[model samples]
Target chain A: MTKFNFELTKEIELLRLVTVGSVDDGKSTLIGRLLVDTKGAFEDQLMAVRKKKGTVKVSSAAEIDLAMLTDGLSAEREQGITIDVAYRYFATPKRKFIMADCPGHEQYTRNMVTGSSTANAAIILIDARHGVLAQTKRHTHILGLLGIPHLIVAVNKMDLVDHDQATYEKIREEMKEYCAKQGVRDLICIPMSALTGDMVSVRGDNMDWYKGDTLLETLESMSVLDDLDEKPFRMPVQLLNRPQTADLPDYRGFMGTIASGTVKVGDELVVKPSGKISTVKEIVTFDGNLQEAFAPQSITIILNDEIDISRGDMLMHVGQEDSDSKFLTANVCWIGDEPLETRKKYLIKHAASEVKAMVSEVNFKTDIHTLAQDEADELAMNEIGRVTFKLQQPLNYDKYADNRTTGSFIVIDSFTNNTVGAGMIV
Target chain B: MSEHKLTQLKALEAESIHIIREVVAEFRNPVMLYSVGKDSSVLVHLARKAFYPAPFPFSLLHVDTGYKFKEMYDFRDAFCEEIGADLIVRKNEDAINKGMNPKEFGVARCCQALKTTGLLDALEEGGYDAAFGGARRDEEHSRAKERVFSMRDEFGQWDPKNQRPELWNIYNGRIHDGESVRVFPISNWTEMDIWSYIREEKIEIVPLYFAKERPMIERGNMLIPYYEENKDQLLEGEVPKMIMSRFRTLGCSPCTGAVRSDATNMDEIVIEAAAARRSERETRIIDHGSNSMEDKKKEGYF
Candidate 1:
């Protein structure tokens, strides 16, 4: 193979965003519009869709099946609804985007959690005509609980209201008030007719009274790197690459992806739970050596001296000690066929650490429509609640709001081996 | 490194390494499934780095489907020799000689008997408690909800809806006897991310990935190659054409297809792959027919 000198000139800024809304709120159409208006659609694909027979010609507006743009599955096309998360990719000169269009139905709440898990920003669509509905509040509340820093409430179907600003503001104010009550600080509201090209990418003159930036502009201007700087150094060991061959018999390295912060060669480090101290010897990638590594980067590390280190061990800055505690308060989204029962033993996975845990108590369950917390004994599907868990072994963690990488966990049912709930440490 | 605010690739790599280590620490007997593909190459590369200063901890298990490109074997052998790791090759010759043609028994059944069954036999014989694969979520819709530590029953069935919720980076690879977990260190990586990582890391892959001169036949818009005995399977319209082509994704020969391209190097291939109209799996003849991929996945085909 020829030696290729690959230089990354432009920093690849890929944003994962999910479009969420209530049923019949045109969330899919809004995404389809964003893709279409930006010229993200392929010529052959558009032409082929137009040629399809017996296609629904809704509103007689060019007869374009907007849902066809995103609903890629045959079943989804036949049913006219998103059954699963449909990921679509498009790139502008500024940045690349991977949009996850999640289902709007209430039963597919688990699908929504799957879609928005990795999203940096969420586009919660609300039909202007209907204002904020039950599903709308559920999605927004989910986004806020998921720790999505930025949100764009795309009040779609402005054409239905003759592009009325009053309807947009009424919904926007209601949404803003609801989000504030739910502790969502950063929110942007935009009125858009996803059917027609209005304030999606290009500025639509119909909404001249609106002073804020367009949807695309708002997304572009949003800070790509938020408070990731505040997160402490954390690298979860995934594998131990100990080549036992005759040529390099003494090779011992800790391989894993860095969850947050940075680690350099010769930096003092500490392994979690076991609390073993070590110094960074070398940082290795597939190509060659690396000087340092940070969050999201997968790399192998060789320590100066061999320490008893294995997988599920976390490597962090040595000076900063992590607390090994057995109990934590967390906000959980129950997603099991069986409702969460108190005192049930479940396996808890926090970062690279796994421990046996049981729900000690149910604090309160949040009302999906009202965002109100009511004391409850159990949680069902699509329900959000605060719960306390007692762990069999001490887990090293930070607050979920502080460091998302180390502060989240999943509750796995011991009997059926199903993931019952996802929790963010409070 | 100081100038760049850790790209998503870096984060993914770190996380994968972490997962790999965790699997090794938690599981008693673990083996990596090497398919001689880009994703597996990344997996091996990460494995080498995960336990640097020492040899790779686990052995590599390759389940030969009996209809692979000859070059893939050569590449696999060469890589094993370079890394000085043990390579375990298993094949279903009994089923093959029994005259089980994939075209007759259906793609899903063929995959189950040839790939999944063969893999199960090898795992049972080798007593492997866990197996690491290079499967990624971005590859398909069904894969999107897959957990990093995906547990399988004694029969190796993947219960999609019943998977453990994987939040943050915590992975639960726990399973009782007769059950094992399929660990994916790079579950979040997309096709673009894999290519970029391959380029950035300068990981060596099969030469078939780059465009080259080869005898190929056009079958339903896909470039099918005429290799060995399979040459006679071509119909009248399928004429051999010497086109510059490369396989975007690798699979069994009969199932995988090559795309016509001039991208002889990584840089050109990345651009072309990024702009490709169809998905990587769209060209696979086996998946093109009926609900084969999903069906095969349900029956424990990796």
Candidate 2:
């Protein structure tokens, strides 16, 4: 279809997602095909893809090379793999989508973590012939650790298996059993071919045996995001906006995005680490003072009384229980070349605060393929292990499952200033 | 600025404002790159809103190419004056002394000598630890993978292959002494989103965006405005005609191209953009080379 009159409002829902799989699992092709068939691509973009040189052909149509879609995804061919998470956007009348095309190589686990942190759902592509490969299990484990709300197992290359129902069932049952063991609660499995455009953007007639919805239909129907107001109030102050302007001579507003839950006027909250109590006086913005503000919305908070607080301090509900901790045992995915050795100091960046931290012990490393826990003394590059950290000071945080934003932190090498690892508090 | 459920546009506005505040809080010497374009205008407005009642905490750096349209300079002057922002216009004095122009030295060398070198010179003189850029991912191909807080090395080289990873909304703004981070808060917004937000917010833009009758010449599918400053370049057979035209994107006057459109306002531009088949960079002369922007960016061209 050529361009026609299309005017849209910003009121539509947006679904943020991440796509992960092993190398050559047709992840790029799947996204490319999905966007192309749904008319998400512009004419010039399609032309550029078609004219792309030195493409490895994966399409039978012979006109456009689908794999070439990964070219500009990062344009950084680091050892022939994507180096960063490339965010792609597409919209339907039903909803808007923002997806991160995460790399699959083992060493780039940090890239995968970055993509999944903000995502509500994950599309894990699994080759039908190679059911539940080691990389597939690794990605699933990472997804589970990140507390992603929904998961979709795209059993690709159904055409290669002649769209066999029994084959799909076997793979689905195996994955379900594994996920159950890994504590993954929500999942949906579908069989399709990204190369042949089956059950991706449209339902193929050959896959009539599978009665489930198409991938797009599933995404459109699922409420992938959580209502932030239902949880406890948490907003780490990014900065203080004391415009101190002419209209209001004395004005002090704490600027931040509510990590979860809501804050209303006169709500009782405590400043973390400082432990000072205050009532929310106003929710300030450029337009006007808001009656209430919730998660993901950036606004300024004004308290009734002057409290001693700064950017690093967090504002949280007083009712949240027993959150102070000096020692953290978290699941960490090491992303640096330097091995994570015990007693080595690193900076823990949590929310807006940073603390001096050192690994106390390496409990065990999970062999992602076998789902076996093996004792390890240290974690090298691309290794995932349960590690204990002793912080120089107490940190107020919730379990990763409770709130994705407040429960996670990053490990920065103190000397190199490199992000070496990503940890989710257990 | 409407107070309601977080709409897409409102979300974008909040995100941009947050980034600006982060720059102010974290960096000692920070500056906003104001190119006198729509994106930079939106960026400066956000900066003002981000620090309401107080003046902008940091100064603004405009790497004046001197080849820019006259209207852009006027808009830059008035906008900065109205907002009371500290605006510093840095021009490459060496190139001006050497009499460098597109007609003499071609688009690449001229842009390099004027914009790239001029921006570096400004940063060196100002010692800015952080610079806020209005680059959107949907605007260019390679920018799709850029971090919200992208880092440039001590020599101002962008290592696209070996860069830091950005996770969640939490950006790593940490850097060394010589290193600097280029933060893009509106990285998620698309071209249509920009125009639509402009209409909703009633943002005042340059008059060159509106179609008007002006003396113009066609050069290889692009319409070039014939300025009085360049009257000497007209050939004996070349007679410029007054045509209705407007620019989808603005840049150096000689390199920027205008389109044949009757879109005279934000609403009309939005409507025209909905049906237009051309990419935004099609009119840019520097990008005519084989994907040259990415290569230039790696060498510290923003």
Candidate 3:
């Protein structure tokens, strides 16, 4: 057995992204091609796919059936479509990538929501000949609703359109107008053929009219390392640690993952939903005590005063407005097959807090294809609608558009406990 | 020892810790299925970090297949004592007394009884609503799209297709009376990630991973550990001998095979794994036939 050099050739920041597009738009093909071009797949992995039993290879040459590289399950292979959100990982010299490959079937749109929810950016693919379809609009709207910081429109299959610049430009203009209306601030449009391997990893000299960065370049250079530390401090306490002993009986600390901003030893703190005030005395990890902590860092913090805090309680800076509300309106994507109805009590899990909330009114549902709002009594599976909630207890949360951490929630069925719907505070 | 900016490693660690904490906070009764392997070691380490200066809210449960290496048991017992963790060892004493061994009962049936049923029996007694396992996606074909919060039915069955959509960091740990959810905090971590993390954290692992001279017998191309219990159960032409080998994955002793390597330390093992082309599961003897991990997991085998 030859020793494979598993060394990191270069230091690369990991970027998590999701690609959403309609069926046959070459999303999986492009992802496979990226791994192949970047040497992400091991030789054994490639060979295993090539020698897969009962699976046909699309190309005769040294090419692989790219779709087979990702649709791993036997059921998915038999059905010829992706069922769940399959996460694929690869790294380039510029950066490492965690790509969530979502299925494009309309019924599987719940999966798209699951995939795109935590993505730092998204690549919405488009068929060059088909132009801007309704599914494209639906995906674009979902990405915006997820508050994904960046967006890339990969206009795939230019080879089918004879690599024409006019068609690419037309789609670009249409997408720009549509995205502006959808509130996508950072958008990049790239036209390439995932099948021909042109401009995916290697910048093939095709369609010279497009002088912008390739999809790979755009993703690598995209500003995903946002200065979250500068934002107001917010950490939802998930666990409370108390080493209750004879010597250290009062040693109590609030443990949580810092969702945003930074904290120092002397900074004042505010426990949400209670407005109890305290000051940071120490930040603790298993390593040792710390003087300061920042977003995404898991730490146990000891405050100057003992505030009545428990699991699902959020701690934040006292003055961070736009991070609190009880009666809130939100855009909900009904993921469960069971239709959502007004006056239905569901468990709304927002950040670390879970509260029993009921939908007071089902405002209206959107026709994703026509971008029209229609009056509806309830939201079914894969349907998006606006609704108002009446919470049993007052909960402090940031708007979904402002802070992705506190602004989003999932509606769990009280009777079944299945996550029935995804909500983004409007 | 100090707060730092978000590196990729720190981010992954925080995410895993967050998941572990959520399970402990949300579930009515949660138990961690400790396998005493590298990934499980990382999970325990994360749990310790998640609740520092305080005792763990949950207990560690081990499903004893009665076929594991002697060194694995030693490591588990000592580690539990060292950490002062409440450890529960659930064994299928009925199946063992009924003469259910891999040599006689065959591989699949033996595993189903000893491993899957062992876990089921433990869960039944504990009434745990959630169980944490150190399963990773990069380890197998079926785990490519597995959710971090994987749901199990009343019969402890996993429906790969019909799973709840886990969005954001909010996990729906809410389950019915008999249903449970298997939480994989380190689901996204690859084998490479596991080894790298172990090296970074200086976590303790079992000595079975390091190659050493041990009594062994080759059966079905697997280097089985030649124990006193299996002295008379050798196949027709198979004889026990001392062989220098190591296990890539630790399972029931009869089912898991040893790989010929000289990685006596974490550094050497990391280098070998990186260069060894074949995935780690290649060393798993039980995974050879129709008994895949996915199917075993559906039957409640961690």
Q: Which stretches of candidate 1 lie over 4 Å from their true place?
A: A1-10, A33-64, A72-86, A204-206, A235-256, A264-292, A298-319, A341-344, B1-4, B102-113, B116-129, B136-140, B144-147, B161-163, B227-231, B237-239
Estimate, for each residue in A1-426, the C-alpha lDDT of model 2 and write its tens digit.
344343446556678889999887889889888777655566555666774455544233235667675565335554577877887877776677888888888777778887888788999998888888878888898898888889999999899999999989998998999899889988999999988888987797899989999999998899844666678888888887775678867878788877888788989999998889989888877777889888777788889999878987889878774377889989998888799999999999888788999999999998987778899889998788999999998888888878778888989898888888888889
Q: For model 1, report DockQ.
A: 0.34
Q: In order, what is each prediction's RMSD in angstroms?
A: 4.4, 3.3, 3.5
State each model's CA lDDT, in order: 0.78, 0.82, 0.82
Per-residue lDDT tens digits of candidate 1, residues A94-166?
A: 5667777778888878778877877889999888888988888888888898898889999888988988989
DockQ of 2: 0.49
lDDT of 1 at B209: 94
Best by DockQ: 3
- Chain B TM, every candidate: 0.95, 0.96, 0.93
- lDDT measured at residue B188 in model 2 versus the true structure, 0 to 100: 82
* Residues B183-207 of candidate 3: C-alpha lDDT, one tens digit per residue: 9999878676677678778899998
By TM-score, how accurate is candidate 3? 0.91
Q: Score the docking of each candidate (DockQ).
A: 0.34, 0.49, 0.52
